[model samples]
Target: MRTSPRAHARVALAAGAGLTLALLVPGAAGAATGTPNVPTDLYNAYQPCATDPNAPLVVAGRGSGVTVEGIPRHTSPSAYYLTEQFRYWPVADPTQIATVERTWSTPGYEATADLPGLVDGSTYAWQARTVDPSNGAASDWTASCYVLADDTFPSQPPTVVSPNYPEDRSSQGGAPIHLELGSNGVSDIVGFQYSWNGVFSVSGADIGEHGIPHYNDPFDGPRSAVRADTLGGTASVDLMPPSPSWIQDLYVRSVDRAMNPSPTYHYRFRINVDAPKITKLSNAPYGKPATFKFTPDAGVQAASPVVSYTITRFGSDDPVVLPAEPSGVATTTLSLAPGETMTVSSLSANGWTSQRNWWRDETDTTTTVTSAQFPANTSSPAAPGSFHFAPKTETSQIASYTYAFGWSDAPTTVPAGKKGELDVTWTPPYSGWYYLVVHATTKDGVQLADTYYWFGVN
Candidate 1:
């Protein structure tokens, strides 16, 4: 039907974005900024509001240009119907919505309204409608929001690129597919939701279903989930696809709620994607303050991000390691001299890694007390036997420590100790034989024997 020009409607999953494209025409001839915008694709672009800034606004995004729908018919010879409505789904779905100016008029149409916003990690459906009175009647509404993608959705998403082992993704198993992901443009990410159809891990789903872990090795087993976002980039996961196993369908996307997404800016993981490798690691200067460097067979990432490199010296400050490039080879400096050693480790480029990787414990106050003596109280005749050892950092085997007491006849693995008096205190597993052996290895064994020795009570 014949109608007057009017404002269009726009419905998108997100609504906080807009652009003002400059024109090639002269300043006098060009359209003002934020005016009635015309686009190549009328399906996605609708007038965000009615009677907005007169200056023409430029639209930019996927699918070429924006489009306007539901032009309004003239309501009267001097007046026109301005068609308008809110950009939203038929039923209230999980989305961010806002009122848009949808109208049609005789001369032209325009709108001014606040844009709607959507929630993260949610699915949203939207459409547009307009109200205009150019030909004494307004036309019907139009369907939008279901814009088609020119290319197929990514079957294999991006992934974290390192710290993967050979047995991460095992099927038959040979050399598993290793994948890692990192984010430079955004903050750290967490709890990745991933999947594999054999070769690839798919991501971006809200539920954790359909995603797979990159556990390719039986020996490698379950390591604590390293929060990928702790690094300078957002949190990213790393895994190696098992060898011999054919990873046909794999997917991975990370969010607190598995596949659900929060920020538009994020990093994904993919398999069969090769990045830089660190073949060699060394510390030069080997002085009290050593500067460690790594030469990767493959090039490093373009960025100069720092990871933590820990070494043992009498005293020194820690330094953050930086990545050479996007491919992943990273390095840093350390200071050490004769008789000193530095334990190398990684710290998240961000504060996150501090909790898990940045710090190390060389001595144990609660843990290395090989033997101890407590005061003989009147509670029991046997003094409580005690010893301390720091918690194990890397080993996962069942640790069994035995404590020998002077009075125990059987294996008194862990018991209390007493002095010349008949009282004694010891460790918990009080079942085996124990003897108060006068430990001769004091100062010899880090002076543990002298500080940790005492005559036992019978």
Candidate 2:
């Protein structure tokens, strides 16, 4: 009859004369050879919710093989070599599925067994025990570890909806779009996998030689997932496609506890959120017709070509609408009064209007006065020269001139002669460079652009 190691030890002690027999009869039948310690710290890929021991195992699919590992507990007689025996069988059938034996003589006491007969929709139970190699003595079987095999994916793909963007329509881009994903009655879903531009991959990290990761290898798979609530399978994520104007599909799929992926669901939409490009003439003449070029932005040109341009001038509510050329560019000649600004916007074929581009004319065309004695723009303090101002045209109606000799000095107004000419005598207070600012005003109280004159007194 089989007996525990402690019971055999008591029997040997009671019979002191027979102690040698008890210790040397390891190979004899019904001998009191010691049984090895039980295995511990079981591990396998199918073990789900590892923190919770009672949780069931979830495999990816049918015919999938898994590797199980265990650490054999050290027993008495440290010199005795030990091995491990593993068994697995489906809970539905009493017949044993497989039994594997491994001799792990290394110091770590680790034993590994491969399970290859797992099928779809089946529950499996496995256990491990340590054995003494010399006398075939074995430890008691470990408690069965249960696993649930699942090959079926979630019944449907995750339902994806966006509030800011509509399906199959053009919406404003360049901003984050809020998306809500929910499982459509398939409760097994635990997370979601998605990708922009409809490209999805489930490829794992590249395996190196000897099943060891290289120093520069990636840690995980190329794809990523977002977890959902354990009970409801609901999640939300903000997605923003590449800027400019993007027209692409957002692909999403549901992932179950077994890492099985569902069918792909396409969320197609177009985005238009770039301001139109404005190419206006630099320093356009005031009160004169100048050509302004309007072209669609690169993003808009790729998705929805610009069909027209809307030009809105400051101080006037009326917007001039012009048709764009086949090249998505429109040019218009319009006059802008002084101190006026304009804005241009492009309209695309999808009826989306871009942000406005501001424009202004900074041309100077006011009456100018020329200096006679200061033609060379230089003078000396000893040779104080008189300053002479003369109009370029004889028909000039300049009534007065406001002149300032220095930046810090106030301006002095002087009436011009009947011939539109003026003269001012000035003596230098110091030998240094100086600037003169002059303004001409017509009889109608209209101020012209100021003229800057520089002179050096050395």
Sum up the clashes in candidate 2. Answer: 0
Which candidate's lDDT is highest?
2
Which tens-of-lDDT digit does each residue in 1-458 have in candidate 1?
A: 01112212323322322321211111112112212212111222332312222222222223422333333223233433243443543223434343444322222322222223332222333434433322222234443343211212222333444333322342221123344554433333334444443222222111111111111211123532334545223444433432212233344443331222333223222333222222224432212233344332211111223233333233557534454433333554443332443333322233111111222222221223344453222122244565443222211211233334454434333222221112234553443333343221111122112122333343
Measured on C-alpha atoms, candidate 1 has an lDDT of 0.30
CA error at residue 446 for candidate 2, angstroms: 43
Whole-model alpha-carbon lDDT for candidate 2: 0.63
TM-score to native of every candidate shown: 0.24, 0.46
**Local accuracy of candidate 2 as per-residue lDDT tens digits, 1-458:** 11222221211111211111121213323213445677776655513213333567665535526555565554555534455666778878858557765553321344555566678778788787776656767778787877667778777888999887888888765335677889878888877878876665442222132222112111134434577877447988876554334576788988776677788899988766467777765444334467778877886676568888888888888998999998898887786654468888777776666667777655442435444445447664545567776554432566788888888879998988887778888776777777888876656565656777787787
lDDT of 1 at 87: 51
Give the whole-model CA lDDT for all candidates, comma-separated: 0.30, 0.63
TM value for model 1: 0.24
